[model samples]
Target: MKKAISLLGWIGVIFTIIALVLTLLTTYHFTYVKYFNDYYTLQWSIFGTMMIWAANMMVFRTNFKNIVYPITCVIIACATMFFMYMKVY
Candidate 1:
Protein backbone atom coordinates (compact mmCIF):
# COMPACT_ATOMS: atom_id res chain seq x y z
CA MET A 1 0.00 0.00 0.00
CA LYS A 2 2.80 2.39 0.85
CA LYS A 3 4.55 1.63 -2.41
CA ALA A 4 1.33 2.17 -4.30
CA ILE A 5 0.86 5.51 -2.59
CA SER A 6 4.37 6.55 -3.49
CA LEU A 7 3.81 5.53 -7.07
CA LEU A 8 0.65 7.61 -7.18
CA GLY A 9 2.51 10.62 -5.86
CA TRP A 10 5.18 10.29 -8.51
CA ILE A 11 2.61 9.88 -11.23
CA GLY A 12 0.81 12.93 -9.90
CA VAL A 13 3.98 14.92 -10.16
CA ILE A 14 4.48 13.86 -13.77
CA PHE A 15 0.94 14.77 -14.70
CA THR A 16 1.22 18.12 -12.98
CA ILE A 17 4.36 18.93 -14.92
CA ILE A 18 2.79 17.91 -18.18
CA ALA A 19 -0.28 20.02 -17.50
CA LEU A 20 1.78 23.02 -16.52
CA VAL A 21 3.92 22.80 -19.64
CA LEU A 22 0.94 22.37 -21.88
CA THR A 23 -0.84 25.32 -20.30
CA LEU A 24 2.18 27.55 -20.58
CA LEU A 25 2.79 26.62 -24.19
CA THR A 26 -0.78 27.30 -25.17
CA THR A 27 -0.97 30.52 -23.22
CA TYR A 28 2.21 31.87 -24.77
CA HIS A 29 1.33 30.73 -28.34
CA PHE A 30 4.07 28.12 -28.43
CA THR A 31 2.06 25.76 -30.58
CA TYR A 32 4.67 23.31 -31.67
CA VAL A 33 2.66 20.64 -29.91
CA LYS A 34 -0.55 20.16 -31.84
CA TYR A 35 -3.95 18.60 -31.18
CA PHE A 36 -3.96 19.71 -27.53
CA ASN A 37 -5.92 22.35 -25.73
CA ASP A 38 -7.27 23.53 -22.40
CA TYR A 39 -9.61 20.54 -22.15
CA TYR A 40 -6.77 18.02 -22.25
CA THR A 41 -4.72 20.06 -19.82
CA LEU A 42 -7.69 20.25 -17.48
CA GLN A 43 -8.01 16.48 -17.54
CA TRP A 44 -4.33 16.10 -16.74
CA SER A 45 -4.65 18.54 -13.86
CA ILE A 46 -7.68 16.69 -12.48
CA PHE A 47 -5.86 13.37 -12.62
CA GLY A 48 -2.89 14.93 -10.86
CA THR A 49 -5.12 16.22 -8.09
CA MET A 50 -6.79 12.85 -7.60
CA MET A 51 -3.48 10.99 -7.47
CA ILE A 52 -1.98 13.45 -4.99
CA TRP A 53 -5.07 13.32 -2.83
CA ALA A 54 -4.90 9.54 -2.65
CA ALA A 55 -1.20 9.58 -1.87
CA ASN A 56 -1.62 12.25 0.79
CA MET A 57 -4.42 10.29 2.48
CA MET A 58 -2.25 7.20 2.81
CA VAL A 59 0.84 9.15 3.82
CA PHE A 60 -1.11 11.02 6.46
CA ARG A 61 -2.52 7.80 7.81
CA THR A 62 0.93 6.28 8.15
CA ASN A 63 2.30 9.04 10.41
CA PHE A 64 5.41 9.50 8.36
CA LYS A 65 8.31 11.75 9.38
CA ASN A 66 8.31 13.77 6.15
CA ILE A 67 4.85 15.26 6.15
CA VAL A 68 5.97 18.44 4.50
CA TYR A 69 6.15 16.95 1.01
CA PRO A 70 2.61 15.63 1.07
CA ILE A 71 1.34 18.92 2.40
CA THR A 72 3.18 20.74 -0.35
CA CYS A 73 1.72 18.41 -2.95
CA VAL A 74 -1.79 19.09 -1.74
CA ILE A 75 -1.20 22.83 -1.71
CA ILE A 76 0.16 22.80 -5.25
CA ALA A 77 -2.71 20.66 -6.45
CA CYS A 78 -5.27 22.97 -4.85
CA ALA A 79 -3.59 26.08 -6.22
CA THR A 80 -3.46 24.60 -9.71
CA MET A 81 -7.09 23.69 -9.60
CA PHE A 82 -8.00 27.10 -8.28
CA PHE A 83 -6.05 28.82 -11.02
CA MET A 84 -7.75 26.68 -13.63
CA TYR A 85 -11.14 27.35 -12.12
CA MET A 86 -10.67 31.13 -12.17
CA LYS A 87 -8.97 31.09 -15.60
CA VAL A 88 -6.11 33.09 -14.14
CA TYR A 89 -2.69 33.35 -15.69
Candidate 2:
Protein backbone atom coordinates (compact mmCIF):
# COMPACT_ATOMS: atom_id res chain seq x y z
CA MET A 1 0.00 0.00 0.00
CA LYS A 2 2.79 2.39 0.84
CA LYS A 3 4.55 1.66 -2.43
CA ALA A 4 1.37 2.24 -4.37
CA ILE A 5 0.82 5.50 -2.60
CA SER A 6 4.35 6.55 -3.31
CA LEU A 7 3.87 5.81 -6.97
CA LEU A 8 0.71 7.83 -7.05
CA GLY A 9 2.52 10.71 -5.37
CA TRP A 10 5.25 10.63 -7.96
CA ILE A 11 2.69 10.55 -10.72
CA GLY A 12 1.03 13.57 -9.23
CA VAL A 13 4.31 15.41 -9.07
CA ILE A 14 4.97 14.66 -12.73
CA PHE A 15 1.55 15.90 -13.72
CA THR A 16 2.04 19.04 -11.71
CA ILE A 17 5.34 19.76 -13.39
CA ILE A 18 3.79 19.33 -16.79
CA ALA A 19 0.94 21.60 -15.87
CA LEU A 20 3.33 24.24 -14.58
CA VAL A 21 5.33 24.17 -17.74
CA LEU A 22 2.21 24.46 -19.84
CA THR A 23 0.99 27.35 -17.72
CA LEU A 24 4.24 29.24 -18.07
CA LEU A 25 4.37 28.72 -21.80
CA THR A 26 0.78 29.72 -22.30
CA THR A 27 1.06 32.77 -20.09
CA TYR A 28 4.08 33.97 -21.98
CA HIS A 29 2.52 33.52 -25.40
CA PHE A 30 -1.19 33.94 -24.87
CA THR A 31 -2.97 36.56 -26.98
CA TYR A 32 -6.46 37.55 -25.98
CA VAL A 33 -7.55 38.36 -29.51
CA LYS A 34 -5.89 35.67 -31.55
CA TYR A 35 -6.02 32.48 -29.47
CA PHE A 36 -8.39 33.23 -26.63
CA ASN A 37 -11.68 32.94 -28.50
CA ASP A 38 -12.41 29.34 -27.54
CA TYR A 39 -11.32 29.69 -23.92
CA TYR A 40 -8.37 27.38 -24.34
CA THR A 41 -6.23 29.35 -21.89
CA LEU A 42 -8.96 29.15 -19.30
CA GLN A 43 -9.22 25.43 -19.76
CA TRP A 44 -5.48 24.98 -19.37
CA SER A 45 -5.42 27.13 -16.27
CA ILE A 46 -8.16 25.08 -14.69
CA PHE A 47 -6.37 21.87 -15.53
CA GLY A 48 -3.16 23.23 -14.06
CA THR A 49 -4.89 24.15 -10.83
CA MET A 50 -6.35 20.68 -10.50
CA MET A 51 -3.00 19.08 -11.17
CA ILE A 52 -1.26 21.23 -8.57
CA TRP A 53 -3.94 20.57 -5.99
CA ALA A 54 -3.70 16.85 -6.55
CA ALA A 55 0.05 16.96 -6.34
CA ASN A 56 0.01 18.80 -3.05
CA MET A 57 -2.52 16.41 -1.56
CA MET A 58 -0.56 13.38 -2.68
CA VAL A 59 2.73 14.76 -1.43
CA PHE A 60 1.26 15.74 1.90
CA ARG A 61 -0.24 12.29 2.39
CA THR A 62 2.93 10.55 1.30
CA ASN A 63 5.04 12.46 3.85
CA PHE A 64 7.26 14.14 1.34
CA LYS A 65 9.92 16.20 3.08
CA ASN A 66 10.26 18.99 0.58
CA ILE A 67 7.91 21.90 1.10
CA VAL A 68 9.11 23.47 -2.11
CA TYR A 69 6.57 21.69 -4.26
CA PRO A 70 3.50 23.04 -2.56
CA ILE A 71 5.05 26.47 -2.08
CA THR A 72 5.89 26.71 -5.73
CA CYS A 73 2.38 25.67 -6.66
CA VAL A 74 0.92 28.33 -4.46
CA ILE A 75 3.10 30.96 -6.02
CA ILE A 76 2.24 29.80 -9.49
CA ALA A 77 -1.47 29.76 -8.73
CA CYS A 78 -1.34 33.26 -7.30
CA ALA A 79 0.59 34.60 -10.25
CA THR A 80 -1.76 32.91 -12.65
CA MET A 81 -4.78 34.32 -10.87
CA PHE A 82 -3.30 37.79 -10.89
CA PHE A 83 -2.64 37.64 -14.60
CA MET A 84 -6.10 36.24 -15.22
CA TYR A 85 -7.62 39.09 -13.30
CA MET A 86 -5.66 41.57 -15.33
CA LYS A 87 -6.81 39.95 -18.54
CA VAL A 88 -10.42 40.02 -17.47
CA TYR A 89 -10.45 43.63 -16.42
Candidate 3:
Protein backbone atom coordinates (compact mmCIF):
# COMPACT_ATOMS: atom_id res chain seq x y z
CA MET A 1 0.00 0.00 0.00
CA LYS A 2 2.78 2.42 0.82
CA LYS A 3 4.64 1.49 -2.31
CA ALA A 4 1.56 2.05 -4.44
CA ILE A 5 1.08 5.52 -3.06
CA SER A 6 4.75 6.29 -3.64
CA LEU A 7 4.46 4.99 -7.17
CA LEU A 8 1.52 7.25 -7.85
CA GLY A 9 3.49 10.22 -6.61
CA TRP A 10 6.40 9.44 -8.90
CA ILE A 11 4.02 8.82 -11.77
CA GLY A 12 2.51 12.21 -11.13
CA VAL A 13 5.94 13.77 -11.36
CA ILE A 14 6.59 12.09 -14.68
CA PHE A 15 3.20 13.15 -15.99
CA THR A 16 3.92 16.71 -15.00
CA ILE A 17 7.16 16.56 -16.97
CA ILE A 18 5.31 15.22 -19.98
CA ALA A 19 2.77 17.99 -19.69
CA LEU A 20 5.51 20.58 -19.66
CA VAL A 21 7.10 19.11 -22.75
CA LEU A 22 3.79 18.96 -24.56
CA THR A 23 3.06 22.57 -23.70
CA LEU A 24 6.45 23.61 -24.95
CA LEU A 25 6.02 21.65 -28.15
CA THR A 26 2.60 23.14 -28.72
CA THR A 27 3.99 26.58 -28.17
CA TYR A 28 6.46 26.07 -31.00
CA HIS A 29 3.89 24.49 -33.35
CA PHE A 30 5.77 21.23 -33.19
CA THR A 31 3.06 18.76 -32.44
CA TYR A 32 4.04 15.21 -33.29
CA VAL A 33 0.54 13.79 -33.19
CA LYS A 34 -2.86 15.38 -33.26
CA TYR A 35 -3.98 15.13 -29.68
CA PHE A 36 -7.65 15.49 -28.80
CA ASN A 37 -8.86 19.03 -28.42
CA ASP A 38 -9.36 18.65 -24.70
CA TYR A 39 -6.18 16.67 -24.10
CA TYR A 40 -4.41 19.41 -22.21
CA THR A 41 -7.34 19.98 -19.92
CA LEU A 42 -7.71 16.29 -19.25
CA GLN A 43 -3.99 15.86 -18.66
CA TRP A 44 -4.02 18.77 -16.27
CA SER A 45 -6.92 17.30 -14.37
CA ILE A 46 -5.26 13.92 -13.98
CA PHE A 47 -1.97 15.51 -13.04
CA GLY A 48 -3.67 17.56 -10.39
CA THR A 49 -5.55 14.58 -8.98
CA MET A 50 -2.51 12.32 -8.79
CA MET A 51 -0.33 14.94 -7.20
CA ILE A 52 -3.02 15.87 -4.71
CA TRP A 53 -3.56 12.24 -3.81
CA ALA A 54 0.16 11.85 -3.25
CA ALA A 55 0.20 15.00 -1.16
CA ASN A 56 -2.73 13.77 0.91
CA MET A 57 -1.02 10.47 1.50
CA MET A 58 2.20 12.16 2.51
CA VAL A 59 0.48 14.56 4.87
CA PHE A 60 -1.30 11.74 6.67
CA ARG A 61 1.57 9.29 6.70
CA THR A 62 4.68 11.31 7.33
CA ASN A 63 6.18 13.32 10.13
CA PHE A 64 5.56 17.05 10.53
CA LYS A 65 9.15 17.88 9.60
CA ASN A 66 8.73 16.07 6.29
CA ILE A 67 5.80 18.26 5.20
CA VAL A 68 7.81 20.00 2.51
CA TYR A 69 7.38 17.28 -0.09
CA PRO A 70 3.61 17.30 0.03
CA ILE A 71 3.44 21.06 0.06
CA THR A 72 5.73 21.18 -2.96
CA CYS A 73 3.53 18.73 -4.79
CA VAL A 74 0.43 20.81 -4.09
CA ILE A 75 2.09 24.03 -5.16
CA ILE A 76 3.32 22.45 -8.38
CA ALA A 77 -0.13 21.05 -9.08
CA CYS A 78 -1.83 24.39 -8.57
CA ALA A 79 0.76 26.24 -10.60
CA THR A 80 0.39 23.88 -13.53
CA MET A 81 -3.40 24.11 -13.38
CA PHE A 82 -3.20 27.88 -13.36
CA PHE A 83 -0.94 27.82 -16.42
CA MET A 84 -3.40 25.53 -18.15
CA TYR A 85 -6.26 27.88 -17.36
CA MET A 86 -4.36 30.89 -18.61
CA LYS A 87 -3.18 29.11 -21.76
CA VAL A 88 0.32 30.31 -21.16
CA TYR A 89 3.16 29.44 -23.42
Best by lDDT: 1
lDDT of 2 by residue, 2-79 (tens): 566557556665755655565555566753344445434654555466455646555555455666666666677666
* Model 3 TM-score, 2 decimals: 0.55
For each candidate, the alpha-carbon lDDT, in order, equals 0.65, 0.57, 0.64
The top-ranked prediction according to TM-score is: 3
lDDT for position 51 in model 3: 79
Q: Candidate 1 or 2, higher lDDT?
A: 1
What are the runs in model 3 whose C-alpha is more than 4 Å off?
14-31, 36-46, 49-53, 56-61
Candidate 3: C-alpha lDDT: 0.64
TM-scores for all candidates: the values are: 0.52, 0.39, 0.55
Candidate 1 displacement at residue 22 in angstroms = 0.7
Clashing pairs in 1: none
RMSD of each: 4.1, 6.7, 4.1
Candidate 3 local lDDT, residue 88 = 54
lDDT of 3 at 13: 66
Candidate 3 lDDT tens digits, 1-89? 66676667667667667666776676567775355233574457555765757556684665677777667767767776777778752
